[model samples]
Target: MKATQALTTALKAELRRAGITYAQLAVHLDLAESSVKRIFSRGELTLARIDQVLALLQLDFVDLAREVAQATPARQALSAEQEAAVVADPHLLLVAICVQAHWTAAQILETYAITHAQLVAALTVLDRLGFIELRAHNRYRLKVDQTFRWRPDGPVMAFFRQHAVPDYFEGGFDGPGEQLALVHGQIAHARAADFHDRLQRLAQDFVHQHVADQVRPAGDKTAYTLVLGMRSWLFEPFRTLLRMPGAAPGIAPRAQARR
Candidate 1:
């Protein structure tokens, strides 16, 4: 999804640089301006159409790919003030979340009750915030990396923890491409660190695959969230049973007493 999004953003940026309007693109492609807009907004353009647009822009797929490679890595975490700005406005916060998911202006407008002007305004605010660069036809380039994350315990995450968490877990995990897993064990500190490193690599791989799958058609895509976490914890019931001073090792206090 990231690749397609990047291509669309690059095309828009090139179009702005070339001062080519959707109407001009329609003329070049012998399509309606609305059709051209739809194509770019949905990012469902075929390779031939993409090439056609690139030809009009005097560029090619390699150029777009290179631009994507150069830009995708620049997306890093937003500063605290920037995040605070987002959480300040409900619409801005919504827009930020949608953009993080690679949602185009059209997608957000279609999916939400936001008007075109409202969405454009949000994009403009994001542009000013350095979260994205607004381009012609209201398209944008993501300023953050694909692996961009909310600051740990930051306002954004605090919001998610308070609201998005319960909503997220409401999923049944029974549908196609859905899953949930839990495992508990005690391990050496070094081994725990190694496990965390592996989880980080796995997250990176998932992000890569997300970009790779952008080639698939929209109909073939389904939004999925992967929540990975690890922590030292015990069931609440087991907590009270923990061994006390001089208690039998690995035995609950009550059980040890009974023995």
Candidate 2:
């Protein structure tokens, strides 16, 4: 990320972590709340303005840099070793996922069977893993950014694909706050890349919404998993029915960028 972008991102996260609303920040900066929101969204703040925000947040440039570094460890990619560590302990993995989702320690304790000590232990593991910076009273900020993703082929993804995916899909789609859409179409192989970008963007939108709704009461929020997928394939049974089995889209190679 560009320096300005990284700084802005870190600034926004600091504000969120501090529970400083845009309205609150606007009062600090002597700007309209709309302008503050725009500055955050578009990252249009100048250096002097960023300094002003930093002063308001009681953070210096070094603090901002540290936040940026923490937010983007390994370019926001986990090592195979790190993934293995997280997947090794089921509880640790659960805690990692919850913390990444911005769940509070109390929420995790209330929602799950984990004891406070167990939760603190899990949090200490995360702190060592650099996924979070443990703070006094168990209040912490996520070290990872909103756009962070687990390795596509890592142990965590493998575990989810083998276990969580099945459970996730078993849910009936006909319910409130639920959707399942399957669309198939043919386009030039090159045009398919466009959809890939859109799916990535949509996934990002979900994370952005998650961040925005953090201010909502924990009881008002529900855990949600978004699965976005696209591919050209004929079912095995349908493949047998296809008179022209030699011709099928997505069979060759997909020009997908790494997430």
Candidate 3:
């Protein structure tokens, strides 16, 4: 069933690549455009219909199967070990983050202090880790799915908490195209969960838009980060003052202060 869906998706992509619209496809297949669209949408095309469509598109079942095989799977979250490997080397972590942000090799080298050799070495490690497939001339293919995520309490987040978070907070968010909001309110648990879901959707939209805009001229692009988060907590001082009378002593929180 999953393979059927994958094949349907690949076929649709091939149709677009071949400039075959639903109207054209319908004309060729002797079906209405709506019917053709429904067949693709539901992945319910009969073998005969599938062959007819493929013939119209000049593709065979083998070709479609190959495309399905090559289609990138949606990556969820990396394993703890993978996250630890990234965190263990700061330079490697930098390269990993750049790739996540859709930075190309030229862009990375132009923006950062990494040398060609260093960048190649980092890409090689990522290839070994299955994060990417290294190609000729230091080019590589991103293996990360659109849904890829860092583990919530993983090493990557720990690094961010230790370093990036502090630097990010230092920003005034007062520049053009920048704004910050700090909202504190009581809410039902269900409502909080709903808000988190919305934030996740927004993050996905941001990522998709970034990928879509890669075709634009580099000069027309600007780097941006959309950080979304939520937590039920309070600053230590506020929590201390709100402690109930005669409650147990407050414990010191572990500090993530840099050495």
Candidate 4:
């Protein structure tokens, strides 16, 4: 339940979802499978090793942190309501946000104000839970896939569905109605799942052709990260409008502008 543990759990799920097995991941990192297993068992990771794994996987620490920060709107608000929710334990909130963005611990601790012992403790919990796997040298990266599904009664599932989304939309929009529409109206769950699956395949292919092609097998160190996912239909209208030539390059007025 510690922040570091939460992060590790998120990382493990992401790695799994990406189809990167422990053995395969060990090969990617140039480490032995047994070493990898031992590191995770101990839940101890050094910052440098963490970096190498993330690099091999084409994930950036800073970008992932920023993505996490941006994904949680509640963290960005300045009002009293926001203050109460976000300030409770910025560290924990930051961890949650990072998990959402699929970031590494190095990314989370860069701006973190907690003590080393606290950070290590958090990471240990995460490692023990199989949320992350440690490198031979004690650095950690996500072991699960980013899109890994949480059990129906898992804390993460409950937290996101119950707290994160509701808090995000509080006083900002029609909540229940919008939720209903999303769950029942525009796109069904099955269709969305299929779309996501296809999207992942496309992303994998793109990375293999474009990003991976640029890297040599001799540890060339050149890499690019590919984030593959779909946005909701809420942006469909804008996406369609943008395709029109000479469309002013911005959002068109809701009423098509006063002629």
Q: Which candidate ranks first by lDDT, i.e. highest? A: 2
Q: In candidate 4, what are the lDDT values of residues 41-140, reduced to their tens digit?
A: 5555456656765676566666335323433212221234333343355454455445434444554566567665665655555455444444333245
Q: Is 3 or 4 the stronger prediction by lDDT?
A: 3
What tens-digit string does per-residue lDDT give for candidate 2 at 118-145?
A: 8999999988888888876786667777
TM-score of each: 0.66, 0.71, 0.68, 0.34
- CA-only RMSD, every prediction: 10.5, 5.8, 7.8, 16.6
Put down candidate 1 lDDT per residue, 1-259, tens digits, no spaces.
Answer: 5778878887886675455788889999999999999999998888898899988976768777866776645757988888989998889999988876666677788889988888888899999998887766675667887668889878898888998888887767778767776666667778877887777787778777765555456798787777777776556666677677334233211100000
Error of 4 at 121 (Å): 0.9
**Model 2, global lDDT:** 0.79
**Clash totals for all candidate models:** 2, 0, 0, 19
Ten residues in sequence with the least summed lDDT for candidate 4: 250-259
- Candidate-wise lDDT, in order: 0.75, 0.79, 0.76, 0.47
Candidate 4, superposed: residue stretches over 4 Å from native = 1-102, 136-138, 171-259
Q: Which number leads on TM-score? A: 2
List model 3 lDDT by residue over 1-259, tens digit each.
4977987887776665444688889999999999988999999977898899888866668767766776767567778999899889878999998887767789889989989989999999998888876655665556777678899899999889898887976777777666677666667778777887887787789888886676567788777777776776566677678658445343322211211
Q: Which sections of candidate 2 miss by over 4 Å?
A: 1-12, 22-65, 68-74, 242-247, 251-259
Worst 10 residues of 2 by lDDT: 250-259
